[model samples]
Every structure is written in C-alpha cells, then in structure tokens.
Target: MTYDAVTEQDPLGMRGIEFIEYLSPHPDDLGAVFTRLGFRLVARHRSRAVSLYRQGDMNIIINADDIALSSRTVQDEGDQISAIAIRVANANQAYHHCIQQGAWAVPTRADVMELKIPGIRGPGDSTLYLVDHQHKVSIYDVDFEYVSDDHNPPALIGGLKFFGVVQYINPESTAEWIRFHARMMGFRALPPQTRFGILPQGTILQSPHGHFYLQLIEPVGDALFDAEWYEQLARLAFGTPDVPATVRILRERGVSFEDNEFAHPDTQGAVTAGLSFGINFEIVRCPATPESP
Candidate 1:
C-alpha cells in the first residue's frame, strides 16, 4: 500500500483523538471518578472486561480485562492511560504512513469476537490507534453493546473540547520525542515561551489538523529518572468556555480542585487534584471554536 510522506507542511490527515483508554484493575473506582467529571457509562464490551463512557464528543474506555492486551501494566500501575485512538481519514493509510516514517507497528491479534484496529507503539507501552472516521457506524458498535437507551447525544459542560494530552518524558528525551512526533506524525513544536493551562513547562506539539495538541513534559529539579518516569501519557486536558462554570458543575458532582499558589481555579484554567490511579484533568478557559461542535 502507498503511504503519504510526513512533513512540516503535509500530514496524514489526522482529525482528532477518537477515544482515550484507561487500564484499571478497579473499574468501578475509575468509573466513579469519570462520573464525577461528567462522563456517563454508555456501553459495555461484548466479550471483554471493558466499558465505554461518553460525554459530549469524548469517549473514554475503562479496561479491566485480565486477558486484555495491557492488563499486566494496569495491574502494576493500578490505573493509567494505556492507549490513545486517533481519528484519521484512513486507518490503513495513516498506519502505513507512520511506519514508513520510522514508527514501530503494533502487531494486531484480535480475538474472534473483536475487530482488529490498526495502530503503532507509542511512548512506553502505550498504543496509538489509527481509526477511520465513521459517520453511521463506530468501532464501539462492533465491540460494545449499548447499555443505555438514551439515544440523545452527550451534552457538554460549559462547552468543553479536547485541548491536548500531556506526556511525561525523561529529562533529556524532550528533543528526541519532539523529533519523533515531527518526523513520524507530522507534529510541529510550539515556541518555548508559549504555554497552556496551569502547567507551563513542557514542549507542545500541534497536530497537523490543528484540532488538538500533544504536550511533552520532563521531570524537574533533580528528580530521579526511573523506568516509571521515562515516558507515559500523563494527563488529558479539556478546553472550556468558562473555567469557573465548569469547575462549579464538576464540584457539584463531587470533583475536587487544587487551590494552591501554582494552580487554582481562575479565568485562565483550573486543575483537579490527582484522582484515583493518579489521573488528573485540566480545565482551561478557551474561546469555543466552531470546529469544536
């Protein structure tokens, strides 16, 4: 199959993050945290220990399957983001394009009851899935069974949209990671002075489509670099039209925010204290764009 060459000007037509998958031994605990953050469980996997949650256009998957692909890591880490599925114009083309540009192809071994999605190995043991845009059908439709009759679309709280995902890397791996995304995934790094949300000390890369971003952060102040601190998809950020309003809604739902000197609820942004399994979220006040709808 032919593949497009990744370049600063030309990309593989990646649209946005399709869904973020979290691996957890205690799905209920993580599910509660998700509910507090305004997500509702909508579907359960047909043959695996997994469930799907939805809010607005965002999809979150909780995988508790002992036999799942990343089960061992989940067992070790308690709960962490294990995979990120990206929406693309064509999954095969995008996968091939990345492979040609030096990405390591993740082997597919779908069971009889599952659909094989194309992907590549990402930082650490995380997998980056490539999925085609499907209007009438979804990959979830094939692997998951709907548990809710509410056919209505998910509602957003204060107009929230995916801003980006933060990745924690080794101290000196910033340039290497930047080059990987730039050469293989068509990501362009932002200037050093440019910052986002409460945490501002990371290298940010904008996707080719400009729908979302990827932030690469390194450990600070003589922190020991262990295998655990090498590279991992750390946190996910959501953009809101009003930070205070969004914080209020989440607070009413039992979510707590950090109120310290460095990061607090304000017109700029707010961050939640680390929830169960070291998962935290950021709420940033950004003007709602037409593409967000």
Candidate 2:
C-alpha cells in the first residue's frame, strides 16, 4: 500500500531505467543496427511482437508490431527513444500508484510468459514499463518464443551503461513534465546549469538512488521544433566509461557515425565512434568524470 517506501526518505523513489524500447517499421533493420552495436538477439515474446537485446547492464527492446504506434508506423528516425522501462521494487504496486495519480494504462499483449508486464503512459504518448525481474528468472523464455532456442543475447559493449535519456520539450512545458515525474514516479530534480555536450543545458532530475539522471532541455526562447512530437524525443544519450575507446570498438564493427565539423564526438547530437545499420548512438561523457583531470 505504501509502494514499498522506495520514495519515503528517498524521494523520487526512482530506480534506474529498466530498459529502452523502440517502435520501428523495419524491425529487421533496427535489429541489425543494434547487432552491429554489439547487442545480441536474446529472446522473443510468445504472443506480443517484441524482441530483447542486452549490452552490459543496458537492456533494449524492439517492438516490431505497429501496435505501439496506434497501428501505424511510428517514424523513421533511428536514435528515437520510444519507451523506457523502470525498475520498481514491485511492478504491480508501482503501476497502481501511478494509476492512482491519474496515469493511463498502456495495453500489453502477453504470450509465452505467464507474467504480465505492466506499463503506463509517458511523455509524447510513450510508454514506461515497470520491470523488476530484468535479471531475474529467464523472463525471455517464460514470456518470449525465440526463433532459435540457442540464441543468446549480446554482452554489454564498451562497459556502457544507460545514464539517462534526453527529453526535448516545448519551451514552456518544462515545469509540467518536471511535476509529472516528481508526482507519478518520485524523481527529484537536480540543481541548475548542469551541462552535457556542445550546448548549454538546463535543470537535471535524478533518480531516488542518485544513480540515474534525466535531463530536460527546452529550445532557446519560444523556439519549438517544427518536426513531429515523436521526432523531438529521439535524442538519447548513453553513458560510457571511456568515450574514445568506446568509439573505436564500435567503428571496427562496421558502424557509421556522424563526424561533421560542427557535429563531432564533442558536439550535441553527435554519436560517438560507433555505427550500426547506419544508426549511431550519441556520445555522452559519463557523469562521474575522472577527478584526476
């Protein structure tokens, strides 16, 4: 009833993001991209159209079905983050709490797995699944029907862990989202002027444990993106221990990256040195920089 006190003394009751999900019209294409990025094809859902990939502690899901986009192709952009999974002490309890806070239920189709993965709506009609057994019992086996029984998911690449996602919202919508995460998920906003790439950024929100941070940035002034809503949410930043080394390993695997003069590894929206299926991941220096520097 108390939601396990994940947020009591620890406000934001935040746990790390459980997994990142993508809704792609070309599942095979996107899967190939991830594979090039060092992710292995792990398991498939028994009933729903979903596949799981693992790299280090980061989990990524590709939902092949257009159901994720209201029976339509979501978009073509590669780096877009369609959904993020959050680890809760108890998924059902967390789902209930969010629902009580006026969160809408996102439908999930369960097949092989006897368990039901609960999800709720997030910004931009995106979904946030409550996952607790990400590393527990063979969730893929119980829920997913893999094409090959011997297929194993790939190991984490470059010691990369999910740091947090970059959410680009309207110039004035910042306060609404800040409150949404705080009330519905127990996230605590960090101090101001926390910067990341080539751009000057804004307030940061940390998970309850202080292990994860989501950055909220608004376009300069009343400037809003002329693109679709989903296009704006595509910017995802991954944390890596060594930016230079991580870039090298990915390049050797046949991945392409953006290396223009203005959009270099040190620039905003610039993916590090790795490319997969022509898709690249933005390089973000880890929050915990070497103090010796």
Candidate 3:
C-alpha cells in the first residue's frame, strides 16, 4: 500500500518504530515488569546507565538519566517513556525535515566513539530519535554490549508484535496532533471507526511503514483523572494473531490483565493490568500468517 505523504515531502523515509525508550531514575525497577511481559535483558549500554531488552522484533531501552527523568510530563509521574526511535533512511535528513516542520530539535550528546542519533522534542519532554540502521552495522553494535548472543529470540506469546503507541492528549486537541503527525511524520489519520484494543475512545494514526499506529486519546465522561493531566505517551500496544492465546500464555507467566467489562480478554483484544506509575500493555488481534504451521 502506497503511503499518503500529504503533499509535503516525507524526507524521514520512515521505515517503522525501531525502539521505544523508557526513562526511570531508578531504572532497576522496570526489569521485572518487562520480564513479565516476555522481554529478556539482551544488552547493556556501553557508556550510560542504560540497558536494552528484547523480545522478537521489539527493542526496549531503559535509561536511568536523572536529567531526562526530571522533566517528566506530570509532577509525581515516575518512570516515563523518554523517546521513540524511528528507523529511517537517513538520520540527518529525518531530523532536519522534522525541524523544518516546527518540531523542536533535541540536543544530542555523544562521547568518544559513541554514535549520536539525531532527535527532536516530542509531545512533552519526551524525544523522538531518528536512526538509520539498514544493512550497515546496527546502532546497537555501536552503543551496546550484548548480554545474549541470541539476536533473534522467539516471542514468548503468539508472535507478539508492536501494534502502536497510545498518547493521552488534552480535550479536543486530536486534530492538532493529527496534523502534526501528518506533516512531520508520514502518518495518515484513519477513519473514526478504525480502532484496536478495548479502550475505544481515541484517534488512530497509521504509519506508512509496517504495522505501526499512534493512538491519541482524551479523557471522556466522568473519568477520575489526575487534575494535573498533561499530554504524554501513555502506553505500548502489541499486535498478536491470537489474542486469547497470547492472554492465556501471559497469564501463566504472571502478567495480570484487566478483567472488567470494558477491557476483559477476548478474541479481539486484551489489556494488561497497570504496573505502578502507569505502565500498561494492550494486545490487539491481527490476521495470522499463512506460513504458520
């Protein structure tokens, strides 16, 4: 399917989401949460207090950067999503194109022999990094040391794959973020009916590359949200061919999912119970491949 570039040139050459970075002053605490979700500690950052966790095609990085954590979206909100690295054809081109579209460029720091991935400020204090890691040495090879030689670990659940990211926005600001993604990134706004997972009130922005989506949701009804609500990347969602099977496997592994009427596990989708500080995972059902035995 050809991507809708919306008149503006998509210099990012967006491939898909390469990795999602989570920032925590006490980074050690997130390991167990990720492990319960089937991620394995596969690498350690060569210089910084960062570690990489992997599961199938997903790569998650935990950064213990106190400076980054201090600017978190809301007061008292701990362990926030710091950055999302988009795989691009050229990092410099991607960064410049985003800046031209009014995105704030994030200052980068690279020590001796370290690779500096270009990035831009995102919704809140979060950063959006652009990495060009095609065929040549992987960005990981330059920055992280392997904790496991097995690069291709099979997914613990039924081919668990990245579905999208959820962003909580202010009321009636959906169109603003929609235009931002359309002009800055090559994402197109899907029809209102196009939705995934159980939490249904949101706008879905589809990436031109891979199975990627960005969901923008705002509080509705008499929801009891913290009055200190600020825009931020809310949670990560995964696409699985078999939602029921994935839920069953994860439940056996001690990952508790929501069982209420709104988010109970079914053949269509399922959502995991929130880890402290608002870490949640949503699993959406996708079509199975013909090659599956």
Candidate 4:
C-alpha cells in the first residue's frame, strides 16, 4: 500500500479536527483565561450551559453543565480538555462508523430549544463529536436554536496551524492502545526509534493529508508513577511560523509560561505573545514540512 494508504484515511468527508472543548465547573475562570489568549466569546449553546470562543484560527468551547458525558472526572481545575469536535464530511456517517467500531455513544441532554449534538468516546474517556460544516447552513442554527446574529468562525492567525496532539499513555499499555488507534481509526505507528524534542516518546500517527498528527508517549522516567498521566493527554502543541511574535502577543496579555532559559525552546516551555492562558499553551519551532515515506 502507498504511504497514504497506510495511514488513517480521511474518508473523503473528513476535514481536520475542528475545536477542543473544556467542561469546567468554573466556567467563569476558564473564560477569563481564554479571553487573555485573544479568544472572543462568539456563540452559546441554546439551552445548555456551554459557550463557544474563537481566536485567530482556533475554536474553544466551555461546557459547565454537571452532565457527565465522558468517563473522565472533571475537577474544577483548569487542566482538562474534556471534548474535541472533529470536522467530518458527514457527521451522521462518522458517528455511525464510530459506533460500529465500538465507540460509546454519549447521549444528549438537549432542552426544548437545544440541538442534539452527537458524540462518542475518545481516549482517556474524552468525548469526540463529529460536526459537518461542509454546507452553508449554520451548524449552530440547526442543532442549536440560538437567537444571536453573532455567527462567525475564527480567523486563522499567522501560519499557526495544528501540528499534532501529544498523548500520554501507560508504560506497558502502549501497544494495546496503539492497536486500538490502528484498528478503530486509521492510525499507524511511526518507526520505533524516531523521537521528538523531550516528549512524545511513544508512536506518531499522521493524518491522511499529514496536516495533523497524533503523538503517543508512554510513561517515561518520572512520569511512570503519576496515575494522572492520561489526564495530561489533553495538552496540545500548536505550531507557529513566528514563535517570538506569538510569545510577545501572549506575554503582553498576562499569559504565564514555564520559562527556563536553560532549555532549548527557552526557560518557558512555550511562549505566548501577550496572551493569557499562557500556561496551557506551548510554542514549537516552525512546523517542518510533512514528507511522505
């Protein structure tokens, strides 16, 4: 099979993963954090306690309802990213495929004026929802009977694009989870010895177009004892064309990063240009072009 054939195929209708949502009991605090990151509150779910925010090129959702949709434990902490919405060609088809592949269906608790959003189980008990924005119809309008005229998507900033996801897995369970991704989704393990900076030591699976990646890392060194290793899977690394500019924008906005000049990318793990929510963000060198094997 060709290289594209080997990786997970985007099933024609599959666009990239759209937005990652966080369900926080402390929605106000979380909203404050994101606003500092240059995100504007764009829309709200009709009847649920959920709101959508958008920045240059990213969309973030904050769900504060006590409804337990995923198998995860949602503490009031600002750490967890509870749900992710994948842009598919057909939301219905993608949902059906996931269910046939043994994905757990997350039931909707829509109110009288709410939309019934479809979701399935993701790794670490996360929720993955399929959204179809292929047509001009307003997604929020059909599913969400909102009355707001504020209907606009985020404008993608700089060359900032989603490079890939960094997922943490148990030390011994890497192979099992690898199989799960490979079979359930069309993910393939990178060559065994390839490595990235200091993280993502497990396997790397590329999407069909190679625009996004899923990097799996098992417990290594000190990470072994942390029972919450899987909880860290929600952390994402965004690739930018200009790290310094991004950092400047973030720093000015009161976003704090873990800076350590001794490190390769500096003392702070990721630089945020004058942006808030700096702790939850990281800056990577320009994304290297994806090459086919």
Candidate 5:
C-alpha cells in the first residue's frame, strides 16, 4: 500500500526536534531565565562550556565557549539561537541530502564534538544539526555528562511540549521561506485561517512528522524598513492543555509575562517577557498531544 503525501515527501527521514542550542556569552544569566521557565540544568558537555537544560521532552543547550563561537557560525554578538538539532534516520544521509538540494554545508569539526554530527546553515546565524539518534548510540550519552540525576524533569505546567519556534524573517520573505521549507523538508503551509498562540500573524509550516511547526513572521509596516531588522529565530513556543493555568504557575515561579496588546496572561496564549538577548517563550492553547492507540 502507498503511504500518504507527508510520508512520501519526507526525503530526509525527519523525525522531530532533538534540542535547540543558544549562543550566549553570559550563560549563567540565560540559565537563570530558563530556570524561571521551569527548565532544570541536566547535563554539561564533556569538552565545551555548554550546559544542557531540560523540561519535559524539551532539551536546550547553552554554548558559552569562545572556541565553539569562533569555529562555528557565530556572527552576531548577542545571545541568539545558534543551532537546532533535528533527529533523522541517518545523520550522514540527511546531511548529504540537504547539501544535494542546494543547502549550505557546515563543516564538521572533530575538536568541537565527540560525535561527528553533520549539519547545514539555517536562517540567520543558525545551523540545523542532523543527528542519527538511536541508530546505534544516543547523541547525549556520547557528548554529555549528567549533572542532575533527574532524567525526566516534569514541567511546572503539565503536558508541556516543544510546540515550535517563531522565526522573524526580513520583509517580504514569508513566501520565500514557505517555499524553502516545503522544498527542503516536506513542510506544508497550512491555510491562513490555521493559527496558534496569542500573536497569530504569520505563515505556519507543518512538519512531515507532524510533531512541530515553524511559524515564519515578517517584519511589520514600520519595522519593514527598519535598519536594525534581521531574520532570526525569535521565540520558543510550548503547548499546554490550559493557558491560564500555565500562566499562573509560571508567575508563581517568578516568571513575568508581557502584559500588552500583543500578549497577555488571560488570553489563549501568553508571551513571557523577553530576556536581554531577545529570547521569549510563548505558551499556546494546544491540547496535550494525543497518543497513538
């Protein structure tokens, strides 16, 4: 029997997100902000100044090493999304597939990582790492040493999942990005009516795996010509069964949310106050993901 379009179009064997990495000089400060969002310091890289934070199924890496910033694509000075690791069937195959499809290859450095993970350049100064997870070895076991014995750190807000990321694109690049994702990763652009979270003003691309989304948002009218506007991964969004309850618990944990027209705690979703590095978290009104029968 033939499979559906999503399965038939998935050339890279894309699974789901493994981890999102951030490049921050002041990792301690970033860690504090993450802690406020209920992430616990779980692991530290064996060879680099990178610490892994975890909450539920989400994994975040904070890379603070100068060597890492120098060798890889760290063009900007401020803290931003450096890389996002995507689990695939075969890291080598996935990496080569992207390169064959006109994707820019990021050279693998033996000194930086124990596992020779292959990757390509993504939007802004970010790389998308293709990891061969559980093919033979788990990437974490090879690269990280557990600092916290708690393997499964429950989120403060129950049923939280790494829903997706919000990417700010340069003006008039929304369609360009949509086509890029469709061609490269088998992502389908949902109908315009399809939306998630409080600030719903963008094109949403659904992954072939149906595990996450990538919302591409272009600059607004005034910011369209703003000299400072640049394309970058802007926000990390999580999905929960209840939005107000999630907001309340996070508030008790000392997390302050932006109470403005764009975002509020009482809405279907709430956007957390941004950190100094421009990173923000959005809690959407998506239900607890259903399990297969």
Candidate 6:
C-alpha cells in the first residue's frame, strides 16, 4: 500500500508515548527492577499474563503472556521491548495512514471481550500500537483491571519524565530509518547542536507533538552486524530536573549506577548499571518538557 501525505497536519494526530511494553518470560524478575526504579504495580490485564506499572505520567506494560502475539517475538531474547503504544486522535485512521505509507501492519485479533487495537511493524520485531487518547474510554479500561486503590501514580523521585528511547539501527541505515519516521510518522530530525543527557551519539527525532523522542544509534566504526543488536530498541532514558539528586534517590533504593570517567553521574546525566537482561536506564538532565529547546 502507498499512502500520500494526507495533510499538512500530522496524519496521525500523534500525541506522545502511551506506554512502553516489555515482553519477558519472567515477569516477576523484571517487576522487581521496575519497583526499585520507583514504579508501582497499578493494574493487571484481564485475560492475559500482563501487568501495568506506573510512575507519574509514565505507564509501562510488562507482558509475560506466552500466548500474546508480541511475546513470541521476544521469547528468545529473554526480556526485550516488544512494543511502543502511541497516543493519537484516531487509532483507526493512524493505522491506515501508516500502512499506506509502506509500513507493514501487524494483524489484530481482539477477543469478544476486548477492544481491537491497531498496530504496525516497527524496527526489529517491535510493534507500534495506535491508541486513541481523545476517546472517553481508554485501552486499559477494557483490557486491564486496576490493582491499586489510588488511580493516580505518585511522582517519581527528582521529578522524572519520559525522555526518549534509544534504538539500535543497522550500520549505514540511519538515513533510511529517518525517512521512514519522517514520512510515515511525522517525526522531525533535530539540529546537531541540540543534544540530550550523556551518551549522545545518535540522530534524535522528535514526535510531531513534541512530547517524547526517538534516538537512533548506528553501530560504531565498521562494527560487524550482530542480529542481537540490529534495529533493536535498547535502553530507555528518563529526563530529570536534577540528575545528581535522582541518582542519589535511586542509589538509596539499591539501584547501582555506572560510575566512570566517561559515563559517570553529573548534572548533565547519569547511566544506570545493567538491570535485568542487559536493560539499562539513562538519567538525563532535561526539563519535564522533553521537547524543549
């Protein structure tokens, strides 16, 4: 399918990340890591082996359901980011538009009790889910049951917010991926002078609504192709008003951070030591507004 640019406006009416999902064979193990990072288990999926954790405005879905479609893709990878759900004005229209833009659709099979959420293939085996944020009903309202008495999740220490996600791309494929996001999803490349946190060696693309970002990192200096790394969504970065204070708070919670000359903690940013399944989190010194210049 070929989709022409529908309008000058963002075709998807994209807002921000609804949630970042991780598929794992061991959900409890990964759940511990999230807990130490200050997330609270708020809900459980109605029909599957899935749970939702929240911190402030950020929502993370941990899918350990063996029967779930995305779980099959990450079964061998131990624990990996399987999908990123994006909030939009209309889920159906967004899904159709992306497919017309040459994006491959991931078939949906919602049961009689569930809502049929549309999705498309993303880099690697990941899926990009389209969810309508303007609707009166929420996707979780239909699929998940609340486990917490308090619906509002408390703020994370040091005022953390979703900064962006780091995606490992194939060597020399940066331009191609950039075009895919630009044409299909309405992401715009940032200027070279604008950098975020530490470990800044990638092309940063901001969502149309300027809420979150996608950092595309190509393998460095003639690096051989590693199927394990190519086109995979690697680490998640959270922006904090104070990096040192955030690190201190996490350290108190028994989270160890990498402390070295190049990547040590500072006002600019900090990197956490490898957590479950080589998943590391980056603490960047950025405003709550991630799209700010």
How many residue pairs clash (N, CA or C atoms closer than 3 angstroms) in each of the candidate models, in the order given?
A: 0, 14, 0, 27, 0, 1
lDDT of each: 0.80, 0.66, 0.79, 0.62, 0.79, 0.82
Please identify which of the two predictions, 4 or 5, would achieve the higher lDDT against the true structure.
Answer: 5
Once model 5 is optimally superposed onto the true structure by TM-score, how far is the C-alpha of residue 119 displaced, in angstroms?
0.5
Q: What residue runs in model 6 are displaced by over 4 Å at the alpha carbon?
A: 1-9, 69-77, 225-227, 287-293
State model 1's lDDT: 0.80
Q: Is candidate 5 or candidate 6 better by lDDT?
A: 6
- Where does model 2 exceed 4 Å of error? 1-5, 9-13, 72-79, 111-114, 133-136, 147-158, 199-202, 220-232, 266-280, 289-293
The digit string of per-residue lDDT tens for model 6 on 189-271 reads 88866788878898999876566788999887655555455677888898888888999999999899998877888899989
Model 5: runs farther than 4 Å from truth? 1-6, 70-77, 287-293
Angstrom error of the Cα, residue 86, model 3: value is 0.6
Off by over 4 Å in 3: 1-11, 222-225, 287-293
Regions of model 4 farther than 4 Å from truth = 1-8, 69-78, 142-150, 153-156, 192-200, 261-279, 286-293
Error of 2 at 65 (Å): 1.1
Residue-wise C-alpha lDDT for candidate 1, range 198-262, written one tens digit per residue: 77878889876566788898888755535456578878899887888889988888889999877
Model 2 weakest lDDT span, ten residues long: 267-276
* Residues 1-293 of candidate 2: C-alpha lDDT, one tens digit per residue: 23334655343244577678877656777788788777777777666677887766667888876566564344454434678887777777778888887889988765443767889877665778887643467545576666665465445465566767767677677788888788777777766756655434766876665556677777764356545443244455676667667667777887666677656654233364443333446666666533211
Q: Tell me how far the alpha carbon of residue 188 in candidate 2 is from the true structure, in angstroms, after superposition.
A: 2.4
Clashing pairs for predicted structure model 5, backbone only = none
